[model samples]
Target: MPEDLTRTARAEGQPLSETDNVEDMYLTFALGGEDYGVGIGGVTEIVGMQRIMGVPDVPAWIKGVINLRGKVIPLVDVRLRFGMAERAYDDRTVIIVLEVAAAPVGLIVDGVSEVLDIPPAQIDRPGQFGRSRSPVMGLARVGDRVTILLDAEVLVADGDLALPAELEA
Candidate 1:
């Protein structure tokens, strides 16, 4: 959690701890032309795009891994994971690091927007429209902007993609 994010959350009267109302807080980011969000709880930190060392025998979406601090974290290209066309990484590109299933994984995104306090009343669950499973947890509407809320666990643990054996706990 960044200082600014904490300040913003506090200013908005949103709780930031496990025993509080953390469920309503989401870290939003830009993906392609739309906005997407993930629960802030699992997010460890956000970092600028770093060099991704290539690895063998992994899905294309698994862009590779990056060494952060003393730990190597596997990077997942969110666009490719969602079956979207690849785009060149730019200055705005970032990696949202998360802890899923007790393992560290990084999600490469277009750019991050902001931390929003979206209450349950503002979110609409994604019912069984067709797909058997979806990464989307719900659709959150903040004023006129709608953000697709994604399940971080599902995003990283999708059927077609699996982290390298060493990356798993």
Candidate 2:
């Protein structure tokens, strides 16, 4: 450690304040009553959930595949993936376009919320959400709500999550 820097911080008592360098936006959405966020850098676009072709061999969490602008992207029910009780779809339902683990997939969320700019400083440290297991990174503030910032790496199940045929490049 540099002697000059260490002396300055010691005088200040508190550790150096970290800067919040938010590079991009997040597509905030909901599952059941909890708010969640997906980094928008990988997002292609958001679309309304439509007729999905069901595949039987897969797990129930894999709701089906949606025909998104002629491309067959698989849809996952976020509520079911988290083992939460799900309700019937309504007008608020939306399919969040996500480019996760190199795949351009669509996640079926209860509803689309808004595009949020969550600064790194405001984000809370990793913690448990009751006994519910989460594959997300941690939580961050969005107005009065604390949205779980999902790790795109585990946003979708590995078995079915593959890069969109067009996005493979």
Candidate 3:
């Protein structure tokens, strides 16, 4: 458990100290065959795929809710969130639990890669897309691979939260 926590912390890019040049660490994952990453600090845990109860009146991307240790956490499919076609959840599917705005939410990703330490020198600002909002934090180059880093806070905006009112209570 401690190791898992350590990995999670590293993935979230928790600053080591005041003098550490490593800007942040990211928890990389896959979605629609493309690599993406999120700050490790945002991730609470990574759990195997489970039953997700559907909710009405919410965006299609917002899959539904899951009973995680008696807490009802809303689930959002990363692929659908990015307008990618829905694919069957296989053995690799995992739900990444995150605390966004103090609320626990689940993000379904194709699979988790590994935690990477990305410094500022390796990150580049995202290019502007006309009339569209982006959830990207920055583009990180790790070795020969590029990972699209995401901002959890921006990804789950207050307006995007459509969990049933009862669950919010």
> What are the RMSDs of all candidates, in order?
3.4, 10.4, 4.3
Give the number of the best model, judged by TM-score.
1
Better of 2 and 3 by lDDT: 3
Model 3 misses residue 99 by how many Å? Answer: 0.7
| Alpha-carbon runs more than 4 Å astray in model 2 | 1-24, 127-134, 162-169
In candidate 3, what are the lDDT values of residues 1-169, reduced to their tens digit? 1234223232354534445333376778998878898887778899999988888888888888889888898888888888899999999999999999888988899998876667777899887545265788788876677789988877766236755577766
Candidate 3's TM-score reads 0.83
Which tens-of-lDDT digit does each residue in 116-145 have in candidate 2?
556676677686555344567767865566
**Candidate ranking (lDDT, best to worst):** 1, 3, 2
Q: What is the Cα-based TM-score of model 2?
A: 0.74
lDDT of 1 at 124: 95
lDDT of 1: 0.83
What TM-scores do the predictions have? 0.84, 0.74, 0.83
Winning model by lDDT:
1
| Per-candidate clash tally | 0, 1, 5
The models' CA-based lDDT, in order, is 0.83, 0.68, 0.78
Provide the clash count, candidate 1: 0
Residue 46's C-alpha lDDT in candidate 2? Answer: 73
